[model samples]
Target chain A: MNLYLGVDIGSVSSNFILLDQNGRLYRKLYLRTLGNPVKALKDGYASISDGLDKQHGKIRAVGSTGSGRHLAAVLLGADVVKNEITAHAVAASHLFPGAKTIIEIGGQDSKIIILRNNIVHDFAMNTVCAAGTGSFLDQQSARLNIPIQEFGDYAVKSGHPVRIAGRCGVFAESDMIHKQQMGFPVEDIIMGLCEALVRNYLNNVGKGKKIEEPVVFQGGVAANRGLAKAFEKILGLKINVPAHYEVMGAIGAAILAREQMELSHSPTRFRGDNFVLEGNFTSNSHECSGCPNLCEVVCIKRDNEVLAYWGDRCKKWESSIKQPRDRLKVV
Target chain B: MSRVGIPRSLFYYYYYPLWKSFFADLGAEILTSAPSNRHTVERGIELAVDETCFPIKVYLGHVAELCREELDYIFVPRLVSVEARSYICPKFMGLPDMVRALIKETPPLIDITVDLSCDEKCFQKDIIRVGRLFTRQARKIQLAYQHGCEELRLCRSLASQGFTMEEAIKMWEGEPMEAESETDLNIGVLGHGYSLYDERISMNLVKRLRAMNCKVLLPEHLGSEVVEAEAATVPKRVFWTLGRKMLGSALHMSQREDVDGIIYLACFGCGPDSLIGEIIERKVRDNKPFILLTVDEHSGEAGIITRLEAFCDMLRRRRNYRSESKLSPYGASLHSFENTV
Candidate 1:
């Protein structure tokens, strides 16, 4: 059996997944990136190494995704590097072939991907704040001395969900603490926080976009039943959280790699099996004043012809490929 | 050889010969610009402030065209009224102030005031005061004043005879004219028609100006110079109407650094000049003092001259101030309100 590996190294968390050619998700691990994705990948690899059935299957292709996908690709010698939007969309499309809306909420940020006829129509990302994301809940959980894993279970039991401010991360913490001092029940406060976060998401990040049904909510935050319940209550529809909740980016990445491999007539350019064992590589950036816009650009050069390029509003510095689809390679 | 710049619009038709004779008697030069055109109008609109109206905006355009020549000064005469009771817009009285503020860069401004708004005694005093600035010589001043006065009387009679400018010019050209109109130093002389077409209209503007006994020009003389100079003061290349006016006017005023005053002929209740005349007043008042003559049929020739004489004299005093004082080189910031907006 041939195995395909995918890694998604995001700002807050990292995930690794393995898939078989039959399109089965074989192995997956999701862990906090903790500002150091290289180590997070190693930890994920450690989990994979423990779980590998070495005699039966061999790792054939590797893919990377997320903001730190280039770094992951450089470190793991990924055969494919994809953007987070594409990775998330592909994973959703594969599971629910007619997925219309893919809402991925994570620790630091959230993304809303709109799909039509299995192709991306439009998308929005909430990079400006953490008000509607999982980390907001984490901050509230820390202040309440409630382990986040139990916060959701408590919300499921709440009869009277007390209100708390969740407009901004800094302000929400203070407001949550104030409600706790006022002797509101922990479950109600937690549920209120969940509702506030969902409302914040709908208002700012979800501003000016049509929200259609067949919505798939998958990210690290999908595990929080309380937030899922709050989104359902506000949106007035059933929310689908995929079974591979935490590692969808990874699953998406592996799938994209498989797609690219099928198109590549040449031999695979991925390095070797010991690629993940190699020490981490670093990335750097510089300002390009080539035009009036003066776009500051990031250059991630494993050797130098940018393994990945971003931060240009005009996308002038993005990686190129011999084929147009190869470059615009979604998922 | 008082060459006068009859900026095609306002008082040039009436007063070209009055100024021609006055400056001719003084043996001074007058320069004028070419006639206003689409390009000139565009240039004027580009230079003037945004709020100025069409006619004054166009007047600024003509003056701007005139300022491009290497002339002594472009004449923009200021008049209070032809009659005692009626008056032009307040913008005429304040045009120098307006021009100075809007277009910051340029050469010196020559301003002459007409305070007929007060009385006749004050008007004469103001005239003498303006004359004194030009020269300290009482004898030369009196002679110039006499020549200016006689020329005005003669031109008025000729104007009252109702001779068309073309016929009068044909007749004037027929004689072995003692002193001819200035053909050098082209500039556009702009003002109201009653002021420009009737020599009596601009208070004997042409004869007195022509009496300078120097080269003269009119609005029909503009060309590449105005366009180039006007563009120099603008922030960015904008195709605004008033911007062209202010720019053209500034460029024209800068050329007449030596002119004792600039005379502007603005009409009463003329909406366009209200704001544009203000911009012109602000821009040219400081560097180059100008006279604003607002003309109605009710306009007083005496009052217009009183204003014109005072403006001319103010230019003389401005020269003294310029020489004696530690003058700051005209600090015109190239950046206008236009850039960020």
Candidate 2:
């Protein structure tokens, strides 16, 4: 029972999925990444349980994606560690064949993917805009005395959505409070906020792009029906949210692992699950004075040949073959 | 008591008047190498690492020549930006740092700050800041800057009035050779400053393509005024400096039915060019069977010309059927690279 594993670790949460032959999933787990991704991997490994432990059920190849994919790959001995864009796009295509566009608003960033012939023709990412991301919505929800879980329901109930400044996060807050003082309904205000966020994304980041139809919206924001409605109104097109919308990145990564494993015809890079069962996997760092960006490169190694290296923008201290590229065996 | 060194390839070809005037105003002599020859290019590659793009390599080679002349300050403009929302490539933006790191030369570089990215007033303030680093006298620096600006204005205006560079040169230095054999195969070239000038890496395509009887029209040939005028058609109001220049060049070139084909010189690892170039290619590539040539330090001249020759051959046969090149039936003064018209 050869199986492939994929892990996506983010600032907010960590996702783990395992898939067997014919791309049929076996196990999947979503755990808050917290600060220490090492612990999250251990927690996920524990959740996957004893099924993968048997000699017959071998872990063939493992791939990692997300902000923490590099370190996770090193710990998990992942065969591939890809950037979020490729991982998300690959998974979206699999989930919805011939997916034209993927609008991903994660905890920290938002991305627009335009795909053609099951291939990504172009993509744009906006890490600069904090106002359009899920984290901003979370903060706004907390301030307005609205539970994040009920945000979608409240937004849909609005009669008249109030307009809020979407250019800056700070400005949006002041404008939001002003509307509330003016006797605007909470539901209406919430819906307005969602519309404003969508407007900001389209105006700033999505500018100059030809956003075609068959759109798939994923990441944490997919939970918000109000935002979905806002997008539909603005684009004049229906949007698709994959079944595993929140964890599509992880699911895509798992699919990549399965694809690579079948092609490699070798043993898995999944450094035994005991990697977590063992004591603290130690790491060290040093200042690489390559450029002005004095990247505090962290090198994680249990024993000798450095298992994983990260924290440098230029990949200064990255494991020789580079993060994701190292996953491939050229031989 | 000190001299200035300038690279002959890039800004030199166009900004020589302004740069030369600025140094002269500062009461300093100038030293620049002869037009790029093959050995100059080879030496440029030796001074620069392989990863740098074309213009950088030519710049390095120009620096190598300047090193022998024994100059004190090389006028390396931290050409930050020319306009808001537009910027030179990150490579150009980070050039001074890259040069200091790469070149072992002992001369301290005079960073002529041209940061137009910031508002004009602030950009001027930074220029003055760099000027203060040179001379203590305020009046002389201002005078030099004014004189330098006057020369640039004159260059731009002359280019605008459709004065043949030869005719305009007669106004400055007397008439030169009546451009021998006016019947050269006309072709339009679109690319960054570095790709066109850096002969070694961009494989010095202009001269080679010219030698093959093809007339090379550079981005500089497309006057800024004409580009700005036609650029109004773009709905995005995309005002990025290089982006505007690129689109303007493509649009202006597109209207010329006489041009057999267009060559878009692209650089490896350049982000803005990749995005904007793709946009232009999607729109204008099929309009005339254009070829996109990419260059890095490792690019071979042989491979480049082979592609160009293939493109020209395809053009010569008229076998390539693209949308008809846009030419007003009246032939209303088709755009010229050297002239705004």
Please write out the lDDT profile of model 2 over residues B114-212, one tens digit for every residue. 767657887667657756755788777878888988887676555434332322323433344334245445787877654565444456676667656
By summed lDDT, which 10 consecutive residues of candidate 1 chain B come out lowest? B328-337
Residues A174-279 of candidate 1: C-alpha lDDT, one tens digit per residue: 7777888898988887888888888888876675557899999999888889889999999998899988888888887787676656655445555654555553
Highest TM-score: which candidate? 2
Docking class of 2: incorrect
Model 2 accuracy (lDDT, Cα) = 0.69
lDDT of 1 by residue, B106-219 (tens): 334545565443367766665565455455665665577667666655554443333434224434435423435443222234443433543323434555454332233333
> Candidate 2 chain A: worst 10 consecutive residues by lDDT?
A322-331
Off by over 4 Å in 1: A49-55, A280-331, B1-341
